[model samples]
Target: MFLLLVQAISLLLVPPLQSYHLDNAFGNPESVWNSLYYVVLLLLFTGAMLIIVRYKVNWLIQAIMAVAVLSTLVYVLFGLAVLLVPSVDPLIAGGVSVVLSLLLTALLIVYPEWYIIDTVGVLVAAGASALFGISLAILPTIVLLVILAVYDYISVYKTKHMLKLAEGFMDLKMPIMFVMPRRWGYSFMENNKGLPAEGAEREAYFMGLGDAVMPTMLAVSANAFLSAPPLLGFVNVPALGCILGTLVSYVVLMYIVVELKKPQAGLPFLCTGAIAGFLLGCLAAGVRPF
Candidate 1:
């Protein structure tokens, strides 16, 4: 439910993000260069994380992540401020957003509790998803998703470095992943014993923030780039199809992992579902998929 809420919030923010004429960091969203840049950055960051963990420089990781969170929150809050008050000056909106972002980031740094992390995390995820969603066009977004899916599989199963990274993040107890307590009164702040043993039933369920963000990019991209008529408000037929497909896939993924205790890469299932649904929806709507 929380993951779904994040995507919905991201979709809601798309119009405002578009209203501000937010463009991709790389000039053309359709270009493959944007995807290449993203991959290179991801590789570098992952390598750096592994090295940090190997050296036991966990504090450094936490600091870098804190900075990352603050910046993402600023972008989200700034966009929302201008969205809610059209007449507000950009400078003022930016100022207010910074202050609020600082406060929220501070809370994460200080308290570092489950609910606090979740509150700030939702903002960061939605903002990042919407930003990337609109910035990358349909084809590039799909390509990126496919590439990341392969990468996720390799990192998790082949290299197993991703698992190591998760252990490091768990030690930090930061806001990078969403946390839900299976039992009442479970406290993430004090659950410092580290992640449960492999195949052990965890007291709290954890989902990566990326899982929510990646699938959402496809939905946003379809809405932004597809020629299909809007099925409801700003959501086009293809985009809505992606949403439905993503939700269904999420259900299947959760069942496999949460219920059956089988661990698998999430994006392969999610991206495949979104792509299939988007294409099917496009065809049904008498529109081109690409």
Candidate 2:
């Protein structure tokens, strides 16, 4: 349910986000430099996160993450408000965005409840995915996905630093991870004892925000860049294929988590599924799969 919710919200946000031209750091989506730039930025972010965690500066990290969340939420909300009220003034939209994002930030800072964290996590994932999707063209997006998938694998399976980072973030109760409790009685705030042991029947399942955001980025890119006719009002055939592929992979990843009872790197499965589905979609749509 959490996976589906995030993907659906992301798909819904893409068209409006594109309308507002909310691309990040890289302006020219087609440039190889764009991919390289993003790769570097991601590495830097990971390093910074690890350093912050090592230093036990969780509050500082939370503040930075909150600011980022607020900025992205403002972008998404501003775009959505403009779409809903086409004649709305930019200043009015900006004010609405600011107020809404600030309210959300406050809720996160104050309550930090599981439901609130999950809800805000979904919003942040959608907004960030849409932003990156619009920023990178097909080739760059694919490169980004593939590279990140590999990095995720190395971080999870090899270095295992990602696990450490997750532990730190979980302690902060920030929206960095999505919380899906197995039972309604689960409380994330009280349950900060770290992840369950391998093969353990856990009280809840946790997935990183990147796990949800990365695959959706491909869907958003396809919707923005592909010329195929819309199969569902918001997305083209290729984008729809990407979305379906992601959900399919999510099922498999969950099976590994639930049935096999293991910790897995989600992006490896998700990116592969999306890329394969995207290629098939491109073939079906009669577009070059480059």
User: 18-131, model 1: which lDDT tens digit per residue?
Assistant: 877875556888887788898999999989989998998978998899899999898888878877898999889989999999999888988888888788878998898899
What TM-score fits each model?
0.94, 0.95
**lDDT (CA) per prediction:** 0.83, 0.83
List ranges where model 1 is wrong by over 4 Å.
Answer: none
lDDT of 2 by residue, 175-288 (tens): 488888889788888876777788877888889999988888888888887788787577788887888888898888988889877678999999999988888888888987
Which residue pairs clash in candidate 2? none
Tell me the lDDT of model 1 at 237: 87
